[model samples]
Target: MVERSHKPGPISATTASSLPQAQVNVSDDNSKVTATIPSGDTVEVLLYGATIISWKSNGTENFWVSDAAKLDGSKPVRGGVPVVFPVFGPPPKNHATSSLPQHGFARNSRWEYLGKSTSESASDDSVKMDFGLYSAGLSEEAKKAWPYDFGLVYSVTLTKGELSTILTVRNEGKEGFDFNVLLHTYLRIKDISTTTISGLLGTSYVDKVLDARESTESNSDLRITGETDRVYKSLAQDTTTVVENGSPRFDVVRKNFRDTVIWNPWTEKAKGMGDFEPKTGWREMLCVEVGSVAEWVRVEEGESWEAGQTIKSLV
Candidate 1:
């Protein structure tokens, strides 16, 4: 709900209401809902999270209740909404991104606001915000190191309380490029020990926890009670990572990809996180990343590719 103007001045009051007819406002705080339908029942989105932070109507519900704040510092925040791109996971010691970075460069970079718009949805009110990041704008020195003429655009929209993200990757130049990409999302949960993730059980995965310390072949379903890290490969479209407690279930549906990185660094590992809060934070969140770690996405000259994820609340 924060001001999303690309200009460097005060936010325009008419920005949200000025959108298309399908858009309206159902929010008191400008930092909450951006666009809405005429009925004011459904909201378009919350740009700060590009992240449909929360949505509720007609007895159904959706909300980012966990204190998963946004990542807005040079140092990563202990817990929050962090964007990941360009590369995923730890880079080689001599790699270009080996400079104290985690889950790639997007979260570490600033995204430019393109504009705003509205749409009609079954949920009634749908709003869309476009955000982009590019390699062309980087410094000459930076280009020399990670040479890839790339442009990543994320179109985040909210309708009927569901947050849908459409990611587009373009090879902005006359060259091919490859990189591991992921949306390193940490969704807040009630408790780590009490929460049980379904759908992934019995599925095969490459254990990163053991891989980080030694080399081995891991092909197993991920059910973690403590420290865990793994990338599940060759997953089916219906495949889902469901975090459940009692009756309701929150599903992280992954698509058009071949890797699912499940991570939870408990105890010592939690304390060692770059910006993680060791005191009372580790258990309230779960990192289930939608990624392309099995292989790199290759974009040809002047072409583009797309991938996305949908975070749905089914309580």
Candidate 2:
């Protein structure tokens, strides 16, 4: 059986003392588990509610998750993958009418560490860790919001050179439930301005920054420039995908998620990012998220849904 607990129990509590802590069990295939933070602390980044906080390594910080949240509680102590679910982006003005937390509480709330296993896919090779959150803990909030019992399971595995995430949502209530979700990932980059996303050519996307009002389809490969944010619609069913291209390009293969979000805070917004480093303009990183925002997933009672993304570094 897998050991389970909520919040960074004893280890996470001691991080304030700089004594080095152990929160969630670090596990690998063969059921082996360790209870200490791993080595290599050149720098640290955060994943807050599925948002990238910051990433620093070897004297250079490539990704910007958020610099401001370090003072607030929305930051993650662990420097790797953080899972987001149920909803993404800003909350609707009427959060009371919704059963979701601000970007859902999966990232902020502690998860029950399920266990570990080997990769089941042949193309990918790495260990996998399982984490889960239930609606039971949020029943009071749910009752006031939408009043439905549901369960969410998130799994993160460090494979080869990248982290992979699998999100599963189950409807445990008698009634149906519906909502949007996103894997709001902040990827580390050599340079954001020089990075280009291929494999999306001829694919159509709904430009969010251009206007949340229209669905603009794209057929050409995109290169990041300014504050560009767009939601793609009716995307191809194939899993072949790519995010960054240069000496090293990140290739992403997704399952079940049909929408893609491309975002970068180019000029003024980049400076305003709380946790973001100063003088790091559009040269930092990009946020290319795999999500389903415009579409609402409806899971029936006793039914469950799963979505995931596998990332590979071609660098």
> What are the models' TM-scores?
0.73, 0.72
Per-residue C-alpha lDDT of model 2 across residues 270-299, encoded as one tens digit per residue: 677555555463466566678777777889
Give the Cα error of residue 150 in candidate 1, in Å.
1.6
Candidate 2 regions with alpha-carbon error over 4 angstroms:
1-82, 92-102, 119-125, 139-143, 215-219, 237-248, 279-282
For model 1, residues 1-315, the per-residue Cα lDDT tens digits are: 787668588566755445446544434644333554444435334434234443443344333223434433333333334455666767757654555255665665545667667765343566676877788755455466677778878876655535567789898887787767776666666677776665564455776677644223332333457787877666655456455464435677665766777777777786665455544566776777777876667888989888877767664
TM-score of 2: 0.72
Q: Which candidate's TM-score is highest?
A: 1
What is the clash count of model 2? 12
C-alpha lDDT values of all predictions: 0.60, 0.58
Alpha-carbon runs more than 4 Å astray in model 1: 1-72, 93-101, 121-123, 139-141, 212-222
How much lDDT does candidate 1 score?
0.60
Error of 2 at 11 (Å): 44
